[model samples]
Target: MKAKVYVTLKPSVLDPQGKAIKHSVELLGFSGISDIRQGKYFEIAIEGPLNVDQAREEAVRMAHDVLSNPIIEDFRVEIEE
Candidate 1:
């Protein structure tokens, strides 16, 4: 089984890296861009025989406790078998 975790900053947090990338894109002639946000992606491979729901629960716990900062970030988890 595999778990995909996407960790991103909360809407209220400022994303300097994303802003810089947006600026660079504008400088490169891209237009009509309003905002950008940066995030982290994690792929975890589970070794045991776990069901989709169990894998999701484990992934969600890991995402909340280890992958993301609860105060400034939010995370979504996907399970693949």
Candidate 2:
């Protein structure tokens, strides 16, 4: 089984990288681009003794404890179907 974690900054937090990308797009003559945001994606392969449900649970825990910063980021976990 495998799991994916999508990590993103909370809306209230400032995203400098996203801002820079937006600025670059405008400088390149792109118009009407309103907003941009940057985020991270992680794919984890699960091996060993755990079953599918257990692996999914562990994946969610990893997202909360290790994959994302609780203070300024939010994360969503999805198990492979």
Per-residue alpha-carbon lDDT of model 2 for 1-81, expressed as tens digits?
Answer: 789899999999999999999999999999999999999999999878888788889988999999999999999988885
TM-score, every prediction:
0.95, 0.84
How accurate locally, in lDDT, is each candidate?
0.95, 0.92
Determine which window of 10 residues in candidate 2 has minimal summed lDDT.
Answer: 46-55
Backbone clashes for every candidate come to 0, 0
TM-score of candidate 2 versus the correct structure, residues matched by position: 0.84
Top-lDDT candidate index: 1
Which residue pairs come into collision in candidate 1? Answer: none
For model 2, the stretches where C-alpha displacement exceeds 4 angstroms are none
